[model samples]
Target: MDRQKYTIALLGGTGAEGSGIALRLARAGHRVIIGSRDADKAARACSELAGLAPGAALSHDANPEAAAAAQIVIMTVPHAGQQKTVQEVREQLAGKILVDATVPLVPPKVARVQLPEGGSAVAAVQRLLGDAVRVVSAFQNVSAHHLRDLAHVPDCDVLVCGDDPEARETVVGLAADMGLRAWHAGAIANSAATEALTSLLIAMNMRYKVPGGTGIRITGLEETAEARRT
Candidate 1:
């Protein structure tokens, strides 16, 4: 699980999804930095995570600093705050991989698919960041509830989408390190599909009364030899 360890930062790391991801990354032996608008809140979250996974090499900082320090930065903020958060860290994110887990779920009608004007949220981020930053889309469909429960292996796979093959594969590896099967799901534009699935999954969760939330899985594909290395 510790293969090619990296210093990863979780922007908006004080949130539920961000905390869960931070825990898993720390457990995978990556140097995990929890980032938040409030530096104190970020540190508190790190302390709590350190208690949950002792000696996990966890730390915290304000979002901008976290982005500057890490090789890879993940945005776990809500759709409403996505643009602002990315803009705040834009300078720091240059020449680094920005993993965006943003889902466009307009409140009150969250179960209904509500894509942004540009068709894909990650694509917008990519355009905003330009070519210097490799923006990869992922984790929009993963259940944050199950992610926090380390004992439970999530019964779902991750669909990683990015224009850059190397950056996309890097995220696939990170997902694997977190103990979940991940696949390269074409380019970042395909993120619209994955983002929409979150709403569909939410609808299903309510209809089926699934407590931990529903997730998507890809069937029938065998792992390639290269995938096995990661």
Candidate 2:
């Protein structure tokens, strides 16, 4: 993959997660398009991301146009809005990768899992996009708070899953560029498990007041000294 030769579009780019991803991608030298339902909001976000990475070559547009302009589209909209966002840009997403960052957090009692139909956001996107778009799931458990810092983001692991290997690799590249450890967690069906972990993490966060929250690390998966000796 050419480090300086890709264009990424972030749908719902006005939000913290979306804008942060846009900012980091822009800093990485990709042509980034900040997309929103409101054209003005997208424009403002592009300006903000530009400040984060000077001469980042970011642009702004309504959802459809933004998706059309970029080779990859990222759906960072809230769960409630995720389906609609995908539908709105579906026509423009044919043969492109759609990175889904939506978590099903239904207001008030968000600590409880509230998964959508099809079991996960990526599944919902795959359904909506049919075979036209390659849906890849990622960033569900990631904290929006980290992306807000343009200077640096907390060390985090991202589990990227999709049926299409190309799509999964594309998202993994983006994750790596953002200073994250990304693992290919099998197909899009596995996304249901990954998304559920976030709600469980939220409950842990409330109970322990752990500011940064909990992240899963596979024990013994790392080649520790004890394992190496065996």
Candidate 2 local lDDT, 50-107, one digit each (tens): 7778888898888899999999888888788877887788789989888988888888
lDDT accuracy of residue 87 in candidate 1: 91
What lDDT, from 0 to 1, does candidate 2 have? 0.80
- Indicate which candidate wins on lDDT: 1
Expressed as tens digits, the lDDT of each residue in 1-230 for candidate 1 is 45799999999888988999899989989999998878778888999999989989999988899999999999999999999999999999999999999898999999999999989988999999889999999999999998899998888899999999999989998998888889999998999999999999999999999999998888767666755665
Model 1 steric clash pairs:
none
Name the weakest run of 10 consecutive residues (lDDT summed) in model 2. Answer: 221-230
Score residue 42 of candidate 2 by CA lDDT: 77
Considering every candidate listed, which one attains the maximal TM-score?
A: 1
